[model samples]
Target: MTSDALRVAAVDLGTNSFHMVIIEECREKGIVEIDRVKDMICIGRGSISTKMLDEKAMQSGIVALRNFLVLASQHGVAREHVIAFATSAIREAKNQDEFIRRVKDETGLKVKVISGKEEAEFIYYGVRNAVKLGSSCDLIFDIGGGSVEFVIADSHGVKLLESRKIGVARMFERFVLNDPISEHEIKLLEQFFAAELVSAAEKAVELGVKRGIASSGTAENIARMIRSLQGVESDVSLNNSIFTRREFNRLYRMVLPLRSSERRRMTGLDEKRVDLIVPGLILFDTIFRTFGLEEIVLSDSALREGMVLHYLQQHYDAGQNSDAPDIRRESVYELGFRCNWNRDHSEHVAMLCLQFFDQLIALHGLEQRYRELLEYAALLHNIGTFVSISSHHKHSQYIIMNGDLRGFSPSEKEIIGHVARYHRKSPPSEKHVQYSQLKQRDRNAVDVLSGILRIANGLERGHRQNIRELRLACNPDMITIGLRSHHEPDIEIWAAELLKSWLEAVLHRTIVFEPLHDA
Candidate 1:
């Protein structure tokens, strides 16, 4: 929403769903998600065998896009900025042109039907950013409703890119005949998949692979169901979360023989994907057995994320900023950029925070893990100012709570939010319901990390980045911190002296701030 930010929407018209992902390209900050909406219109339903668009499904698809444009407008995505791509189902359908024409006439959006190879490449671009997929050999594959695209590659670059017409929807229409799908059907489906994926499998073996990365709704559904069985919290992210062969086998066994009704009641199974999951299971199991992958990493990004990246690459020079090494850091940086944060001051505070965390480790007794949480919290401590400077700390906590930060587990994100929440105002208290919801260990993390952030923020008073170095000395009863600054340290010393009390209480020591004049 900044003056320089260009908000755009990418619409993926897949066989089973109509999804629109809206993002803003914020210069060096990279792509930040603005909003996304999806409608499971199943536009490709019955089109696999008929080789034409279904009238009802096409009508529903138009409605979905019409509504998507409204959402894009709400998010400030102009018509010219919206790009819609139809894959697999539409690409092969005879009436694809009619559907595209109706959509454009009604919604003012042009639909580009992309080929299978193009889809695979776009997916590669998408998953690479999310999963850090620059390995010596990383196999990226996405199983869509109508086709599954496979890409075999390594750090050097892509080795093989292919697509097959064995998607879950196609298999479901062709193979699924019974509720609780019989043993005979399972064997037949596996045989078919074995034949279809033979080439991709052979290449996967020839090239050798470090890991398999699965991106698509089917993969995410499976990961979630498995995690549900393992009792993972619902808020925890499935992005880059892994499941071993054993885990997949366990889920398959539970799902394979279940009736449609039974599967519908299952935990973590999306109601929309209940029927498709049967064939989905067979396809995924076949891929696993075919490729000899011990484990697969789940990516939240797929074609939708790829579309954003591809668009950014074409329009803006966006790709892999070394400054933000991982998705977690990049995601955090994007959120900070969206809020138009004072990067110099936030980075300075974060720098000071990490320094304090290392120097005070003995007193704090916190593990190295807390160091990351502290740093992210410091970087985002002022983002609430995006909403309004008034009680911006509260707004900051709210924003961080719902920012949907990728690559961070729910607990880690919660800890970061709580730390940022307490950066300015009162410390964590029992009366604050959100703070009280945390576990004992997490509450302690918030307390200590926020305490560090408070002093760091205080030292950077006036956003001057004056404090260059910190020297700490511990005594039996009191601790003294020496500050070295390029300018006079009167304000920083005065501000930190006031903010050090919360940290003193947390560390159970009296604290003193002294300005050091070094020759």
Candidate 2:
């Protein structure tokens, strides 16, 4: 926990499920997810059609919320900081006041029943950070139980936001009468969806939205099942994961006719979502067709993540400009900060690593993408010290491997961990189990990146940031690294001399370090 870090909990009381995400917000790091828990309480099960909360479902929601609050408290979130928002079901329920009063009286948690428009706005805030919205208009949507909120947005800001009443739970309760969903019901659903979606679809077309950002559990589950059908298995969240209309059509066709019992066994399809998935599949397929979307990218961050961001925006200036433009670098810096790293030394090493990487790119023969990895690895090379100073390099690797680093894929995270792990001690060898398991291409990247990191780390051995700047001269047989420092960097030079062998061996170049006193 960073000393000044504020831990907050955001709970989404949805129709089909209740989700709580514990987030730690740092002034510098933005929002980092600490832990999250979800319960399939199905709170809106009967409420969608009846417009009244079911007694049993209301009780289940209360219990789930109590548990969420307990977990939040265990994670050190203050009561005031634990914010819960009720969407769709509760908002539309006639007994909404009754449930809110009960929750407030029993658990002291004030459940704010937000409007569909507000929900869409919060969802926009959350997914915009998760996915790079770029400069073009993109349709962002969250399919809740009672309503599906939609937004048309770009890097500049949101241009349109609306919430429709065609949510999966609501549609399922109203239209789905068969296990496989009858053709008649399907036609009715299509007609109803078209009528309900005409305004949003027209707005999407008006905004020229060809790419859509899909959020919420419904989108994530669908994306996961689609990946599973394609034999792609990833433990990572579906956030920013892309699926083409062709791929989704393949899934929609394969899944739409399956019975509930058959659908339950589909890999990556949630057991709880077996029945709801039918309407969900139809809904997204309709969106693809109606909105003329080319592809949909998943954003696991939806209402819950949105709630937190909304809170932060209202109360603090922390996550405002920190998440969007260059999230990769921000995530790296946040991880290092959380580890209580020596910022000056780590930043100096990263600076030196970048300098070495840029000048020696020709020798390493690595693509420009690897340069970003090298810089992030250098920044977080010593974060294992957060666990212990002894064998901190190994700890650093473990941390990076499981650090919940944003804006990176699983393989990319592994590459970063391997680079940070090999920054010190022995160079990468066939004897290391993890290092050996990497693909040959990744292994080669690690070899070059870690080799560069080693010399860079050694250059700041004294941890004083004595070396102010660098100059690299590449010759056929030798690369001379020039250090500019106010005082003699004797220790740094000696350390670099000793540590130069790995990089030299990797690039097959002789290395030399010289001091430059002028500026």
The lDDT of each candidate is 0.87, 0.86
TM match of model 2 to true structure: 0.87
| Cα lDDT tens digits for candidate 1, 384-443 | 999999999988888887886776756777899999999987988999997898999989
TM-score for each candidate, following the candidate numbering:
0.81, 0.87
Residue 498 of model 2 has an lDDT of 85
Candidate 2 clashes between residue pairs 3 or more apart in a chain or in different chains? none
How close to the true structure is residue 87 of candidate 1, measured as C-alpha lDDT? 96
